[model samples]
Target chain A: MAPKVEHEMHYRRLGRNVGLGLSLFAFVAIVFWLTLAKVQRGEPVEAFDHTARPSLETQDSGN
Target chain B: MSDASLQSNVTTPAGDAGFRDFVALLKPRVMSLVVFTALVGILVAPNPVHPFVAFTSILFIALGGGASGALNMWWDADIDRIMKRTQKRPIPAGKIAEGEALGFGIALSGISVVMLALAANIVAGLLLAFTIFFYVVIYTMWLKRWTPQNIVIGGAAGAFPPMIGWAVATGGVSIESILMFALTFMWTPPHFWALALFMNDDYTKAEVPMLTVTHGRKSTRKHILVYTLLLAPVALATSFTSIGGPIYFAVSLVLNLLFIRGAIKIWRRDEDEAQADKYLAERKFFKLSLYYLFLHFTALLLQSALGVTWGGF
Candidate 1:
């Protein structure tokens, strides 16, 4: 069996590139989302209107 | 128990541990704060989010918060083993191996970030990722043991949820969300320092250099009062935002007054009085701080839900 006495846990041992990549990915993804999504028109979803629908009585007002 | 026996007891492979042990590693209590604040953030946004999107986003955010907690536990296993308050945590209690916690934390972090990105836009995902990184790397690994100002600065990690929630709905940050973040960031110091007063011995034992251990109780008291004073304006200021209304204003005013009153009581007490009273005031203040956050956030929620208008900007 492999050695069990020690466990690998040092985060600093990872390459600088990996850290840079991770940081860049996080920031770039956020910026990209903001620009791309904010600039474009989003699909409109209808919200339930509490007070604005026309009453049936209004349709026969001419009578 | 013997050293060898103790080592063998806790060093069992990951499969030997129970499910609750795994859950314990996630720090569910802290995750609840994250979930609640994030929900507030999403709800307070200028745009309303679909219930499904809100649910999915919050679930991923909680997972990310949990991931940060697991990683924190893994990194802090040594200190956790020593501290009375944390000695029973899965790693320190010998139920889960450090390696397993480490692996689990990393996996959850990755999944939460990626899934949040897909579920909502990438800003929410990125914010979640950043929050995890800050808690795990910046606050846990670096600031925690290094400085007496640990809670002061590390509070940012906890403060980001509302911003992330806002990002999920609007896909960006704003002055309003920043104020929401500031409210939590400012509140963390006095809240934690109150606990530090009562639990100073535990931190001293752990050698974690909490504000109380590094600074004397008198200075810690002064610091608590000062932060509370600073916190009042920010807490009240949120009432002028879009999310704030008449209900929020009334609640914020009362909570801030109570918070200031508690801090003043803490500031005025000496060690003799504290020992005689068994730190009762400090404990009461700490408890009030918890309600303080919940009530203030809940007030904001009430304003949004009930459309309480007179005080709204």
Candidate 2:
């Protein structure tokens, strides 16, 4: 068989795939950093749980 | 399938779109201005943002701006194909499909708004959403072809970035934020009108109802001078606000004088004179207008960085 050769189109496709991957990775990193900063600033970080939490109880009572 | 046949099958019209074409769809040049003004908005706020939060918020804002750019390009692709200035854009150039551009815009719009809200605050997110809507729906879809004053009112979309940035930090609006918005809002008319004076053929060919096309170049020149006259006070008045300082005042005074001088030269000329000089005064005024806005914002950034104030206010 003839030696397989890489074409210019393959390189362009590779480049686009790499760019997309990097953008996604950067997005994840940004979200992680934002979450870390918010937590460090002592802003409340709440996720829905089936049970009641003290933080929500206090916020609701205050409101 | 054979490898050669597979390669040929994959080479469709839309298959040639590279990553850069997609970036081009985002209008990186316009996004840079959005990023810069939004950064200024964030930095000059009375309250400080966490560096990471600020960074993320600005990224999302730029994304939102880019999203709107994509949407604008998609909607305006028909006129874009007719305009000399826009003929080489991704859609008109056939590098990207129009449907692809629309989907890309909608996806980025949703992501940017939601992420900004999560990264900054609800106010910032809502402002971003409104800005996107104003640009895409109100400006591009509705006003752009309907009236000669399209750019006059449409400029509000571009002016909202700093306010959004201010909201990111302060979680609300204020006089300072409003002033920054006003500065851009007031400056946009002359900046675009100057371009219209030079690129009159583009608007004419595209039938976009630009002031120059509808009212004539002489009328456009008069409008430019009138708007520049109005712009000077707004630029100068920003200096007395909380964000303003001695440096900003000095910068604004000098720039406004040059701007008015250029506008006067433009207003005084007839088409015969302008044609002889290739619209030199108008082109020069256009170039100066870019620097005028950039330097004003830079001055505000300097005031914040140097911790200086005019002491009078």
Candidate 3:
């Protein structure tokens, strides 16, 4: 077995990986915050749930 | 060679793109302009947006702008290689492949539009989508190489950010947003033509058919002055709108006078004089055009912040 040494290329690749990881993490955080804000504002957080709901019907009719 | 060395060599191929290379594909400078104008749009709107929502919406808008830039780089790679000014762009520099840029652009465009729709409203999402399409398809693909009026129409893509920001806040368009659009739209030709006057060789080398290249420098200079004359009214008209105030009006009046003065200077210089001084007047006008827009937008932001109204209007 031989000792492995780090190369300059390894540092570059690591930096890129860290950057990508942080970007994805930030994106997820934004989505979470947005959902929280929307819910807090009392806006109906509706999505296609594959089942009918009276709330959606009432909201649609109101609109 | 040792096994570790062989493995490292295999993993890090020559010219492998770093994260910065991908960021370069986004054209951060242009994105800053988009972010600033869009932030002004959000802040100046009649209705207020939640701080988080505004932040996310702006992020998505900037991403959309970056996507357009990537697509533009992909499509313009051939011309970019020929032009000295654009020769070091990501695709031209071989840091990123054209197909990679295309895919990256497409993916970001979709994500930004969908996220913006969820974060703000559908209208903002659609406007961002249209901006991306206009810049990539209408401007970059069609208008750029085909006509001298390329920038005139292509400028609309750049102008849409504020409108989208207003839509994010108000969930619709209004007179203020339209005026903001008009301000940027009318200002583009003169800004770009001033640049064209100074960088005439880049367009000539790239066969881009700029006003200077197609219509001749003399005509281009005349066009700059004419557009500046027309732009002044639009710039001033915004001062009378709801977004306008004493500060905005005062700022706009001074900037417009300076802008028009610079344009007249550009219009007056012949090639002999321009060559003697290396297009000093044209260069100064181009630099002032930057401050001209920045100050105009900043003044609008100030008006919103001060909550002042134009009593004359």
Q: Which regions of candidate 1 are displaced past 4 Å?
A: A1-63, B1-11, B311-313
Q: For every candidate, how close is chain A to the native chain A in TM-score?
A: 0.36, 0.58, 0.57
Summarize candidate 3's per-residue lDDT along B1-313 as a digit string, tens digits: 5554555533334445678988999999999999999999999998878999999999999999999999999999999999998998988877677888899899999999999999999999999999999999999999999999999999999999999999999999998999999999999999999999889999999999999999999999999999999999999898878888889999999999999999999988999999999999999999999999999999999998987775644
TM-score of chain B of each: 0.95, 0.95, 0.95
Q: At residue B26, what lDDT does model 1 achieve?
A: 86
Docking model 2 quality class: acceptable
lDDT of 2 at B160: 97
Candidate 2 collision pairs: none
Model 3 misplaced stretches (Cα beyond 4 Å): A1-6, A43-63, B1-15
All candidates: CA RMSD in angstroms? 10.5, 4.2, 4.4
Q: Which candidate comes out best when scored by DockQ?
A: 3
lDDT-wise, the better of 1 and 2 is 2
Instruction: Name the better of 2 and 3 by lDDT.
Output: 3
